[model samples]
Target chain A: MIRGLRKWAVPFAALLVLAGCGYDDTTVPKPEAVVTTPAVPTTPVKCDNKLQSYAPSDNRGAAIANLANKGRLVVGVSGDTLRLGSRNPETGKIEGFDIAFAQRVADELGVPMVVRVISAADRIGLLEKGEIDMVARNMTVNCDRWSKVAFSAVYYNATQKVLVRADAEKDYKGPQSLSGKRVCAPTSSTSVDNIKAIQPDVVAVLALKHTGCLVKFQNGDVDAITGDDTVLAGLAAQDPYAVVPKQGKLTDEPYGIAVNKGDVALARFINSVLDEMRSDGSWKDTYDEWLKPYLLVDATPPTPVYGR
Target chain B: MSQTATPQAAPPPAAAATAPAPAPAVAAKPTPGLVDTPALLNRWQLIGMTTAILFGVFSALIQFGGWQADGRAADDTEQLVRVQEIQSSLLRADALATNAFLVGGLEEPEQRKEYDDALESVLRQIANAAEAQPADREVLATLNVDVTAYATAVAQARDNNRQGFPIGAEYLSGASTELRADALPILDALVKANTDRAENAMAGQHPFWLLVLGIVALVALVWLNRELAQHFKRRINKGLAIAAAIVLVVTVVTAFAALLRDNSNDSLREGELATAVSEANARTAANDAKANESLRLINRGSGEGFEDLWSVSAKEVEKFASRDTRSGWDAYVAQHNEIVELDRAGKWDEAVEIATKEAGGSTESLDAFDQLSQQIVTANGTQATDDLRSGRVVALVLSGLTLLLGVAAAVAVSRGIGERRREFA
Candidate 1:
């Protein structure tokens, strides 16, 4: 019996050992690389009077008829530009300096206000497509944009400025102070280009929006953020460590309300609304309510230019 | 009973004298009238005993392999389910966080607690899965890093949101994007690995091999019996016959058991295990869709991109949802459609109200579906694993018995050949 068992013992023991074999180490597959197409460049358009708009008129009926969605003034604005146009966490409503102007236009037109949150890059496209009645999202009036869409006269005289750490605020004097430092701005906004053009040595980083830049700043991914004084003021208000030191402006960013190129009547109507805001002291009240605390300065609305 | 030895036939005197003297170095040649019957009998005994013993070891070893395979299949199934649960819980946490963001600063405390609990469950499961499956440890470590990054970003978002900063929304959106990009793919790999392990393990039962082994052993036994019978007057040797019968019986019984086990495993792989995996997929997709819904709302008017993602996730849920959980999913889909209609009509506030409300809302409806799907996954997964593990002890005992029975058969062969030798002497 022992000999019989011994004959197969080696193979049996080998089988048992094989049973204890382990599997190979598992692996995670790497994600496929994203392919991005290079952007096509277009020639910059130059016009004599980019700030000029249609003369103001009180024609609510025609303006309402020209709306993309009748009975609702679908105006695109930023929901992240704090004092200019941002959503209130407490009330869950968009209320700020820019939103005040949007609400006033809708009220005068006797229509409901529908606030569409949009990025700076989308403002021109949305207006030209007639997807929105107007854009009040701190859009800067320039010659290139004037060919694509009509603009209400400059409503606020904003100047490009840089916001840096509070500790570094004293050393900042001009765009040259940002040379070789990483400066972030909204991707399609003119602020990054303006700073880069002036210093040439500054590393320009772009994000989806100004608030996205602020996120990068808080995370120490960028050395400074650059945008309009009004936008920088809002960003500064959010972070105590950030400060916009007194410095020469990189460029004059004249804010405007944009409409479709063919919507002259709506553009005139928006100018009329702006005229009312200026005369009734409502614009001042709005500026005081939303911008004064952060800007630390008293301000008056810009004189509206007309006769385009 | 002791039997008297039979009288041997004496060799002829002339034949013994004529046989050459035995060589010192080589085996002596057989005389013309004499045969070496004892040597021949020893060779037959060795062949018969070796065949019987080898048959016993190989068959038992095969059965033992099947038993171990079933155990591994059960463990792999459990790990598969556990990894899937971790995926579902991670998405569940994201859904809760995004939905709470829709409510603004003061999120519902219960919802907050649920989010916390879901994240805690994910972390705990990741640790357990690492411990359960060593092959998965590396990926789980990377997943832990991604989850930690997401959690940190969410905390930052909450802090900014409390201060009413719009950057909070950016932080939340960024965290959501990172979670999908970094953490989800690792989980996908883990799920696929465990799934393959479980399915392959289920195929381990080999009834055909067992049957073939039995047939080969029986042929050897028959050949030995034939050789013994040709030399002896008896047509059949009693001990050899008993040994052959034992081999035949063990072969049939073990092969039948193996066949039954193979069929049972096939049924489990198709039925209960399939259901568990499907329901888990549905639950994960459901949570992903819900998170997209909240993201659409959070993005407000520019949420067309998020809406497109929601459509894709909804289709996944529809495809994988089980029959018992379909009603809940259908109800949630109806509510989601309503939210979409309201949002498209530019009634964003009303849409948000419907989405964030505690009752009669999309959140409540989706919660119902999520709960039902989770229950189905747990119950069916447990049942599948339990079925795989149930007959382990019996298989082990049978293996041991087979080895002992082979020894007994070998002894029978030895005794039968010894009896023949005694008769020859």
Candidate 2:
């Protein structure tokens, strides 16, 4: 019995030993792949300025009555633009020339004011959408925009110009000197389109917001920034190195309060409010409070141009 | 009679080898019985010894090949998943910070809540990963500090922005740069390292030695049964037959289980891991793009850098974007283009409005990005867990079953042999 068991054990042990060894090669894991994305350029809208005017409508219309009935004039204004409609950080309230104008309109209408913070792109859309009663956001009055939205008579006159490094202000005096140089401006605004139209050779860098252009200039990324003189002054005030050249007032940008296209009564009422502010010294006082220090020059308010 | 008696006393060497032992050695006259010498052991001893050795070898194969190897793979996969979680959360947190900064001073309640949630998740995931990967401890420590600094910078910026201070823009820029430069890169590196480890574990060569052992045992059982038949002159030996049958079944089961493990590991290494990495990278790019959009607004620079960043990152996101997320990305890109157009036209106020508006502007795009990113993370996470779990369960169950079958085969062999031995006794 022992011999028989020994014979079987030897073969079984040999099988076990043989089964314990063979070929194994380690496979290296594949590396991760990286993705690459490319940038696409934007196409800006062309300015179509064709100004319109209307005679004063009798009595408040449905739109004006609706707003009056609501007891609060819902007006859109910028909370970022320095002198026009900037927020007072201390008070946590928007207080500027635009806000002052909105308040005056609301007072004349005998309605409490409801200020809705808005962006340059939002002014017309909100007005058209009936989301707001009026847009007093330092909006430029132009012929093209007049086709889509009604505007009050021009209350403030600003000039389009270039803001450059203080030292380069003299060198880049006007649109003519900006040829072949990189200029930054906000998108969906007339400024970039105007730059493209007038200074075709200037490379236009479009920012999502106008403030973005200011930062770019500070970073030395752009040769100059072009916009309304008021906005340029605001940008200049923020940066000690930047200056709006006194000589280069590029174009006239008459500030107007935009309303819905067919709201003739609301347009007339807003126009009357502007006329009152202009004659009553309130407009001058508001301007002096917010913009005088930045202009560094004595100025008279622009005369209103109205026709029936 | 005289010759026979002489032979029994002292036989020729060759003839004596074939003869039985002398009767005097038995202690008494032998009863009539077939020879059962020590050299030719009882059937019970043969069956018990062969089956026990075979069963032991089979058990070793199952433990080493199926259980241990698979356990290691599962562990590696779990580590990789943790890395992914940390990375995804970090990206989301960075995006939230940028969003809050753009809102300017006292971030919108919704955005703040999201930011807080993302940060909390990141902190938790980092802790979990650190426990398993000691090397991650150092990175996690640095991340904690960086996140704190980022939060401080965001707070300072918010304060300045609330007060209408231009310095707020600079603060926001600083915070965004910190996230892009410090936190994100470290998270990415940790993910890469863990991914590599998982790949190595999953794609490793299976235990071919186990297969060899199983095959060898099956052959040995068959050979033993054949020998039993020839020696015993029986058509079949129930003990050896039963043992051989059980080994065959076990061998088949082991092979099938091995195949399942091989296929699962292959899919994980080749398909799932790659998809996970792609999805993660795309999501990161999308978030980076969104943050850049906010930066552009806060800084309001006319520089093309922000726009360029948006374009590239959006494209990267689109490459892996599913149908559900594609439109969101598309809408965002379209809205961004409009905002750019407005900004370029000297309509700074209008551009700001579109970019920062609460509805129907850039916010819509951001919402889409958020949805897509969450979806990708969720899908990849589920897939990773399922793949590893399935493979592990198969290995574990097969390992246990293989062991049980081996033991049963040995016992059956021993009992069959015992019955035969009893008949002889």
Candidate 3:
């Protein structure tokens, strides 16, 4: 019995030695595998469309008084965004649909609109910091943003879509065609996220600006440029090689002027101004002048959807 | 009881004659066999000899450290700037290539021109980087090969695309993969190596030898002064004391300058270097995300793969982003989800519209990143410049001090010997 036990013990010891050698080098920690979870809410964003127009008053709110005292409507506009809010390189004048809207606000306030060239990232922060009194640089009104800042109204309703090369045999008609294709979008916009949600297999590239995506699309670095129809139209216009498919719209983006969270009186006043603009056909005239060429069709201004 | 003036009163000749008598004696105590001679090292002569040796060694040490530090300042900054240039050019080239391809087979004239210009810029940047870092020639050579391959692939892909071939997309995908996997890793390695080199240079302080020399010189001076005082029945040798004081002062000054250089290097590594690295990574992520977008169109319906890629890169960019850019990143993420939902629900056109829309979506996020990254890059550059300048200045000062100390040590000892020699003569 002792001899048999000894034979088994020797074999067991050998096995242990073999295991120790393997174990010694394999103890390093492995990096955790990243799992992508869909962050889109199953329930659509809840929006409030309540709008009680403010009565015109001589006693301006603190925000309005501050702007009046400053003698200018400090409005933040995108300098690089083309056909929307951009500075003319030769003229050095800020011109776009957003700029026009901002100017209207200045006109009502009896002050000049001092256009401060700002990027999309600065829209909310600049308002909160009081660096700019209002942000009209193609800002979209959403539930997430409403919590942080006040929106005037949905001044413009834009649709999301794809811009692709026109001469291609197989048209990227919809998200299904975009599955394996590379799509370029600005990091500051919802385009990339939308592409990700629609077809998780689609390669989404985020650029610093829409122009960055446009450039990438034109260079064959990306298969298509995915964004709002308005912006896609502008990009398509720039490059005769690209076109927006007449297939369908991706999502509805309601553009609004953003004010600081605490500026309720100013927001109401701005909403009233928007209401007047919508009724008087002033908004349509502005849209036609700045956005009509890219839009290719005369679309009426979106009715105000105020979240108050 | 002053000794009679004698020409043979020099220390060296006396030491040579009685050298055998004290050959085995390591003790400092003097005996009768010892006599003063300029030819031999008596205690005072010994002081002068040790001082000269110590000062010479210390001077070499200080000079070597200064030269090394100065070289590091130039090399590190140049490498860093080169890395930045290369990174920018590579990213731009990739963007241009993709945009050109997106224009279909014919490729738009303006877009083609832009692509050509971007490629040319990348070549120039690589050449510039190579000129500065000869040791990186091997890595640059690999990059050069890879870039050529990428360009060739793109051109072929273009031809196929113009003919309306589906295979064109495949070629384009292959090229993009090569650039991301093969090219980027090499560039990253180059950056890491240069950073390490800079850190090593900054931390390179070898004052131990100088300290030992200073201590030894001081000991020799004190012992010699004591021995001389006993021989001449005087309490001090003013010249030797002055020499010792100069050595002490210069050593302290040299040490302080080295300290300054070290501190400046630390500041640069912790502040500017850190910021630069973070921004570079963010930029890379942003560019990668753009590249993945194109891949989504190639694969068509399986865009979730690209989405995963974008998600990782976006998170990385967000991680390094400053406060100003954080809000933009958050918004971009929110928009991304809506775009995805639209696509998944068969509203591909709608998803595209939202994605391409103005004032929101990826544009907002990208703008935010750009602003913050630009700010970070500027700040990093300023800080790096300040730190490099500080290091160079400290090196110059230390080098100058070493030279001054060497001269002072020589002058003080010579003057002391001259005074005694005059008395003896």
Candidate 4:
């Protein structure tokens, strides 16, 4: 028996070696860092009155002809900004303060309204490209945008402000309180530059939209979020922990409806609609319904300025 | 002649006494030193036996190594397919989740269940992969953490969406971004590592080495036969001849078997294995494209970025799609192009309608392509692994038989040399 075992030793040893075969531990490759281009600063164009627009006219025929799509009024608006222009989950319709204005313009033109959701950065580019007839998203009139796109008269006077965690609300006095803290704002918005100008030391982060900033604030990625008071109000209503404390405005963000630079007739038509909303007292009523509870202030529509 | 007398002869003593007065002419040719014939025969027998036995051991070992390599190749192929399945499943889950979000807060129940099922498959497969391959355990562990984080974020997004919060979109977007950044690279590494291991293991058949070993053994046996024949006055030693014959037969047979196995492995690596890997890639790309479609709608008018991403993923699908899946992919592409046209024409509602509809939509075509590609991957992957494993048992048995044959040849050598010794005595 011993001899027989000895005779089978080589095969048995080979089997043992085969059984013990193993590989080196596998390794995971490190993820490559995502590269993003920093926003470039351009020379600001100078203009006397950025809030100026073509004088109001009831030339609905010319404005309808200027529509990119013949039968429908394609208006770009925000789908994520809650009180201004956002989708309602139950109704599956985008209805808010800004959307109401767009709907009125479409109604007055005797056309169907097509709401196109867009980001803050694409507001001017989409207008210039003739993709939308007008942008009723809470876009501000500024000298830089005035060179690229035409705006209707200022309809709402908004002010930029900062929102902080509710626990940090007591210490927040103004932009100075956010010094040396991370603050998030929508990319391409004037609010980031406004906050940075005031404190000069606040680290400004950017998101695709205001709600995106709220997400960052909730995730503790940023200590505060800065945007228009109305936009901040919408963001604050979503999170109980977030609060926009009583603070002075960083800048007067005069809201306007942006149209293509060459679409002066459409600009005139939008102003006409805004004028009607103001005369009919519907503008104040819409404000009371949407912005009153959260803003805690009675407001009136900004007087439309024209003569461009 | 008297000095050269055999030691076994009785006359050697008398001859030793009488032959001393012999003539010394030409310095009397020196008598060849006495050879211990038995010792020489014993030495030749030992050399011959050892050569045959060693040939058996080494050749059998080579064959055994080949057999083991096939088994390992099968295992590696299985692991490769498993990692790829995890990749596809994760993307499939993302596609379902993103598509469901297009319907607002109240998502379709079936769609939600599909998303859940896909995610569950990913988690379960990760665990299975870790258990199957010890080498991949660490990466799979990290992957598990990333997947859990993604799931948590999606859950938050869903809860918020149900309550009509716009921040829910942000949550979903962040989750998708994190999944691609954190989880995908690990999966890529696993795919690469297993691909290399499987290919390397498949190439393990060494027909050249087997041939070389056989030739060297044959040469040694032939030389031993020559040495024995020089003394025994025969051109061939029967025992050595038999051993050489055994060596030749075993070399031809085992070498041929190894060559056949090598060719089979090559075929499998290029055919079924390639199909499985490429089809799996196509499936993953298809799912990625579908997710980008939903994301474009989610982002609404500013979704040009997502549209560009969709184009890229669609191109990837086109590049990797097999003939079997091309028709389904083509149908999906046509539908996708129609949606893009409608979106560009500012008919977003119409585009969303076509995109979100249940039947005759881009979703249905893409689903068909995904399912077909998945089936192809499973079938071809199983075939490749099975082919590698099927005849391994026969290979093992052949290896053992070669060893026994070697020993038999060694015994034949001993007996044949023993006959020469007996004749001399």
Badly placed stretches (over 4 Å) of model 1 are A1-10, B1-17, B28-42
TM-score of chain A of each: 0.95, 0.79, 0.78, 0.95
Across residues B1-425, which tens digit of lDDT does each residue of candidate 2 receive? Answer: 11111212221234345667766665233334544321133443454445545564455445444455445556656666666666666666766676665554566787778778877887777778767666567776777788777777777666667667554555667677777677766766666666666676665435454566666776766666666566566666686677667777766666666666777778766666666666766667777777777666544423356778788888888886655666777788888788778654434456666766778878767766666766766676567656666656556566666655666666666555555444434
lDDT tens per residue, model 1, B1-425 = 01212223333344557667557443345555665666677777778777778878887888888888999999999999999999999999999999999998687789989999999999999999999999999889999999999999998888899999998999999999999999999998998999999998888777788789878877887887888888887778877888888888888888888888899999999999999999999999999999999999888898989988988988988899999999999998988899999988899999999898999999999999999899999999999999999998888887787777877787787778778878876
Q: Please give, for residues B1-425, the per-residue lDDT of candidate 3 as tens digits.
A: 01112224333343456455554443334445664344432335434744654574455455455555546654666666566656655765665565444333355576578568767866776787777767676777778888888888788667655654333554576678778777777777777677666666656655565566667777877776776566556687777777878878877766665656666677777777767767766766766665565454333333567788878887887777655556766776676677677655434445545554345645445546655665676577666755675546556556656655655675576566556655555
- Ranking according to lDDT, highest score first: 1, 4, 2, 3
Candidate 4 — which pairs collide? none
What tens digits encode model 3's per-residue C-alpha lDDT throughout A199-257?
89989887766766765675679988887777777667666678887767777777878
All candidates' TM-scores? 0.94, 0.55, 0.51, 0.90
Model 3 spans > 4 angstroms off: A1-308, B1-47, B95-118, B205-213, B354-364, B371-375, B390-394, B417-425
Report residue B377 deviation for candidate 4 (angstroms).
Answer: 2.1
How far off is residue B231 in model 4, in Å?
A: 2.6
Which is better, 2 or 4, measured by DockQ? 4
Clashes of each: 0, 37, 117, 0
lDDT of 4 by residue, A1-308 (tens): 23533765877697658744799888876656799897687888999988888899999999999998789998999998999998776556788999988998999999988888988888888888888889999999999899999999998999998899999999988888888899999888888888787799999898889988988898899999998999999999999999999888889999999899998999999899899999999999999988888899999889888899
Predicted candidate 4 versus true structure: per-residue lDDT over B2-72, tens digit per residue: 11112222222232465655565622333347455766677777777777778888788889888888998
lDDT scores for all predictions?
Answer: 0.88, 0.67, 0.64, 0.87
DockQ score, prediction 3 = 0.01
Return whichever of 1 and 3 wins on TM-score.
1
**Judged by DockQ, which candidate is best?**
1
TM-score of chain B of each: 0.93, 0.75, 0.80, 0.90
